[model samples]
Each structure stands twice: as structure tokens, then as C-alpha cells.
Target: MLWLDVTHRPGQAPWVRLMGRYLLPPCKQRWHTCAAFLPQGGLLVCGDRRGSLLLFPCSSSPGWAVESAGIADGGTSPVSEDTGSGSEPSCLSHKGALPLEAPLSVLFGLHGKMGVTSVTCHEGYIYSTGRDGSFHQLRLQGQQLEVLRKHRPCKGLQWIEELRFTPDGDLLVLGFHADNFVVWSSRTGENLHCIPCGGGHRSWSYCSNASAEAFAFVKCGDVMLYHREAEPCEQRVLLESLHGREIACVRRLGAVEVPGHTTLNIFVTGSEDTTACVLALSERSRAAMPLTRLSDHISSVRALALASPVGVFGLLEAARKLVLVAESFHHQRCVLKVEAFLHTWAGGERHLLCSAATDGSIAFWDITSPITDATDALHRAEGEIQPLGGCSCQRLCSASRGRPRWWLLCSLPPSTTFFHVPDLAELDCWEVAEAGGELRYYCVLCGRGLEMLHGIAPPESPLLGAPQ
Candidate 1:
């Protein structure tokens, strides 16, 4: 095994240094497959093809790292070149690296001939599993590894692949049997659940929170989610066919508060299938149920923008169609009823609204003023700003600095531009105070993963600000 030292600088990329190398025990059938580092530092546990767990002491006192630099050409060096240059190699080793350090202990035949597949250390005990359909626990005693317990295969679980423990300390074993993925619990030594997923070769994940446990796996080309609540409940597929095609964007609309019921959040999703879907997410059930699906777009629905207070939303399509939707919360039905909408921006004034149309025109309106019908409101774009180079604005956000400023996202060329609207009628504080307070940091979602940006406050920012 090769040991490496990695170092990172303040503003530059990290660099690695070669530390030391050690040789593993020789095996005829198979070699090391999985490994785990013990909770206590300087000790590594490796599982090999012969169903044995080997412990290697990587501490500095072992002389592997301490004397690695002074290891001369031949002074008790772990590596030795073969005098018979034509002889076949027995074990792999570094030519000029430090001599091999024998393992502190090796526990053999723990998983029989199936070979160890995974090794993990929890608390202070070592746990290993193999295709032999069982997992064994071992403890380090002096220089030897003693087998403490063996958990045999649960019914229907024939070949074990891996195991993990829940936050509550219940052991969860994952494996396959009869072409189905099975989860077995060590607390009861029984099958917790089974999902027919063809075989164990596919990708899968299992997670548990205080109230529920979730398992997701890929079957064929579709993803399946399974949920189990801490309290006994019937299982069901909460969402069916969320979209006709791949989803492109998702945005939270708002939250609904109802007495004695789960707090539900409203979310809107745009899809490549030329549709937008409204969903109600229930925290208690851990399910997202579709409330409505808007299928009026001619092309793919690529982006969505929402103005929650007035229930106005905008859906941007691949084609030049910007559809406006207005929805109202129906408490009795626990649903939102759509009225009419496009891309809406409520400025510093709540009554005065602005929207960007597909034809690249900006329209302003006094929503609180009298309107005979929806048709009147749609046609009455009181003060229309001329089209800007035929580029439709897909999104709009209003910011305030004594007067209202609008941020617009343009389509076709896909650019962001801000406008200082000084003459727009009646400004009500469209910009709401920050809900909790000024943010200390913010997160940006990127292709790789979420990135956190810290130091949100400027060097001269105040320690306290106006409360929400």
C-alpha cells in the first residue's frame, strides 16, 4: 500500500507528497478488496479475497514513516530485489520503498470462501461482510483480532454486499436475493424491506432521518423512491408520472399553514416536455403530490419565475411564448387555482406591477385599480416599454434604493440587465425586509455540487440591523 501526504495552500491548488509504502500479505486466490480506518488513528483494517480481515499499524512508532527517509539501499529495508531476475514475482511491492511491515493481526475465515467485500469500523469494533452471506464483528485484543459476533443472512438475503448503521444505532444490511435488492435489519435479524431491482449491480442509496427512512435506486432507466415512516403506515407511490419528460427547473412558490395538518410547500417545475407542474410537498408523508399540470406551451418549458404575494408566475418556453399564470390558495381543497399570469415583478409599491412579455416589451399596471375582467387586465398594459432588440425577458426581480430598480433576465441571447425605472407610477415597498435577518452567507448551486460563499457582510457592515 502507498501512503501519500496531501497539503493545501490558502489560495492555490493542493499538492501531494509521497509518504511511505508497505506490502500486503501474499494470497493465492484473491487480493485486498475493501478497507476502513479505525476510529483511533494510525490503524487501518483491510479485507481481502480470502475472507480475512488484516490490521496494519501505520503509527509513526512502527518505523515505516519515521525512518522512511533514511531507509538505505539494504539496511533492514522491507523491499528486496530478486537475485534471480527471471523468476516470476510472488507479491507486488515498490522497488526502492521502505521494507514491508507485517500486519499486527489477521482474522481468517470470517466469511468462509466467498471473500470479504466490505470492511468498516464503528465505535471501537471492526465489522466485515462478504458474499458468503454473512457479516462478522471483531475486536482488537492485544496483538490479536478476536471474532466477537457473526450475523447470519436474513431470509431472502442470500449474498451480502454492504452494511451500515442508522443514526439510532440499528444495523442496516444491504444485499440481493432472487433478483431483488433486500434490506435486512440486525436489530430484529429480519428483512426490513425488499425492492425488485433486477439485481444488486445497479446503483442504490438508503438514508434515514428521525421520522422516516428512504431508499432510492435506479431500475432500468427510471428512478424509484421508497419511504417508510417511523410510525406504522401503508406504503404508496405518492407521485405518479411527475412530468412527461425530463424536468428542467424547479422553484419553491410558498408554504401553506393549516391547523393540525402538515405544513405544505408549493413548488413549480418546468419540463422539457413543454409543461409546468405545481406540486404540494408534505413533510410528514415525505411525498410530493401533483396539484396541477400546465400544458399550454408549444415548446419545452425551460424556466420559471414566481411572485408569491400576488400569486403571479411566469413560465418561459423554448419557443417565444411567455405564459402568465395567477393562482389563489383554496384552503378547503388544499390546492391552488390558476387565474392568469406572464413574468410579473411587484415593485416597491405592492399595487403597481411590472411584467416582461415574450415580444421583448415591458408592461406596467396598477393591479389594485378597478378592472372589469381578466381580459381588461391583460389588454391594459398602462405604460408599455418598447421591445428591446426583440429579446423577451424571462424573469424580473425588483430592488429598492430610494426608488425601485428592476433586474430582468432576457431570452434568446440569455443575458441579465437591470433598469432604473424613475417614472413608473406608485411605489409600495415591493422589496420585503429580509425574513430572518441579513444573511451571513449564501449557497450557490453548481454542476459539481453546492458551494457555500461566506463573509456575506462587508468589512464595515453593522453588527445588527432592523428586525424582520
Candidate 2:
């Protein structure tokens, strides 16, 4: 197994070092659903198989604190018996003596709830759906969790998969079973429209905003674009038989300009079939056509994100490039994960392609140089693969920075690991002891490292070498 340090300063070659390994404490209950990052940062919201929600904060202080919103008898623990008098705990004080400010707000699901598969945030509002035939709207106002609105018996929307907000802040929900995709008003929770997506054994489906009136969702080898025209929504199947596999993630690359022609919108999709495809959407047709293919991974591609510049530039120049990170697993174990930085150049040509594989190995390729034929376009050359230390990463997200600064969340059972990219190096690790009760999720609000209370380390802090 190769380990890559997630952090390295710009312009300097990353150094290889093996840090101590840690494990995440086993939760009282197993978590089988997905986790999402908050809009501002420092907070991660996750839902469990049992329809329970947990918030985890990234902190540098002592003692980890988790708040359960809906689990029965499972909310924030009391600060101290004599601590403060209120419906909520004055503070969350752990055995490590770490103190957490009273939760700003907390939302609990209906009792004994199940099938809350995904959660997403936009413009300070949290939207969620579940198997219970419910759609929920929550707002975090100060330290209070208030339900803005709730719609039940959403009719055809059951087993919701993911929730997303369009660039215009309209709510979009992807569900499982019948008429799986629906769009709603963020403020009023009104169902704008619903579309029937196929059911059974699906991977992650991603939705990205195309225009104020249009958005796209990619899944199961197809990309569907929807536009709000009159009263109801209009739908178009932009691309089908894409990569011949289930789409894992999709991101709008921005736009590209063609001299003497209308601009084009580009979108990228990663799939389980080990391929990433970029599609160009024409303004006139509002239809996406295949642009490029990134065949760098040997296994299923788990996640994909375009560089901020590529995404912004796509929106600007109407030309967008993408950086795709993929994880390959065999027999349920991660074999190798690779990251690639690729761009589409002028005249819709595929240009630069840079990749880093799991063995702390990196490769850079220039796809501009023409070969004997257009069919043989890419030129492969090896760069440097510096080994950091870690087995594999569970989640990865890019920073809001202009350049590529990726945050990778690596799970090493019983320990929560954090890594940054450019040169994949470990930035911080928290050793979580196995405890019996269910562990909830939390996120830090401030990004300037974790804050310690009374000299006690915060459990969520990624800073290493602090007091345990």
C-alpha cells in the first residue's frame, strides 16, 4: 500500500514520511449513508442507515463532541447538571474536558425515522428528504434550529437519494423508486416538477446548475438536462450511453466561446466504468454533446471535481477543464486511487492531462502534441510520485481557493483523518477510541484551526501532537 502526504508547499517537491496511524472509534451504531459538507465550512452533516443525522466539526482542540438531531434520546448531551438551565445543553463538555459552545441550532427528524439518504445545503438553508415521504426545510438561525417548512406525502417522491440547490437557489431532490427526481421552491417547499428516473441498485447521481432556468443530473450512463420554461419544467435527455456505465459525479465545467458562433456549456461526469466524459452543451440546442474522455483510472471512479479556474473559466470562456479523482477498489478493498488534472483547449481540443496514482506516484501528460493521427492524440509521460502516508481516502473536496487545494477525508477506522492535496500529505489525524454509544457528526465553523478550552484539546481538531 502506498501512502501520500496530502499537504505540500507550492514549488517544493513533497517529502515522503510515514506518520503514526490512528483509528476512528466504532460508533454505537453503524453509519451506512452519505455525508455532506456545509456551505461555509467546518461543519459536516451525515445521515445514518437508521435515518439519524450527526454533525461533525473539524477542530484542533481536545475531546470530540457530536450532536444527534433525530435519534431517540440521542441529542446533544447535557453540559453539567448544574451547568445551565435550558431546553438545550449550555455546552457540550466531554471527558477530555473540551468545551463546545451551545449548538447554534439543531433539527431532529420525526421519531423512529428511516431512509434519510442524503442532505445538502444552499444559501443557509438545509433541504432533506427521506423514505418517510417527507421533504424538510431547515434553517440555522443563530444557535437555534428551526424548521422553516415541511411537506409530507410528497406523493411520488420516496427514498430520496440526494438534495441540491440550483445556482438560483431552487431546491432539487433526487429520489429512489418512483418518479425519482423532483424540483421544488427553496423558500416555499412547493413541488415545481417531477421526473421519473429508473430505480434499483444505483450509484451516486450528481446535479449541476447549467443556467438559471436549467440544471442537469447525470446517472446510469445518461445525462438529463431540465429547464423551467412556463409553469411546469421541460426535460431533455442530453447524452445517453455515456461511458456505458453508471455516473458517479457530474460538475458543470462552465462555458466556451466559438468564434462567430454561440457559446457552449461544458459538463463532466465520472462513472463506475472507469471513464470520465466531458460533454459540451450548445446554447441554441440546450443539448450536451460528448467533448472528451479521460481514461486514466483502472477501476470505478468515485468522485470528480473541476479545478475552480476550469469551472469558472468554463462559465466565462465557455471552455472548461476538469480535475478528476478516482478510487479503484477490488474485493471491497481500495487498490489504488488516482487524481487527474485535464483541460479542453481551443477548438474543443483536449490539452493538458496530469494524474497522480495511489502509490504516491504522479504523472503528467501533454495531450496537445499531435501523433500520427487524431485518434492517437495523447502523449503519456511520467512525472514524480512522492509517497505520503495513508492507506486510502473516503471523501475528497476541493477548497474554495483559485488554485488546486483539495481536502481529503481519509477514514482509518476509529480515527478521522484529514489530508490536503497538491502533494497529498496528512495535515491532521484524530484518534477516536471505540465507544459504545452512537457517535454523531459535527463541523467547525472557524477555519483557523481548532480552539482548545481550558487547555484541553478539541476532539475534532486535525492538529497533530496536541494533548490527547
CA lDDT, every model vs. true structure: 0.56, 0.43
Model 1 residue 390 distance off true place after TM-score fit, in angstroms: 99
- Using all chains and alpha carbons, the TM-scores for the candidates as numbered come to 0.39, 0.30
Q: Name the top TM-score candidate.
A: 1
Question: Candidate 1 local accuracy as lDDT?
Answer: 0.56
RMSD of each: 26.1, 30.7
Q: How many clashing pairs per prediction, in order?
A: 13, 53
| Candidate 1 per-residue C-alpha lDDT over 76-105 given as tens digits, one digit per residue, 9 for 90 to 100 | 423233434333231223325455567888
Give the per-residue lDDT of model 2 (tens digit) for 6-74: 233444322223221122223454443655557766555555556655455534332332322222243
Query: Runs in model 2 with CA error above 4 Å?
Result: 1-29, 37-42, 60-112, 141-144, 179-197, 204-468
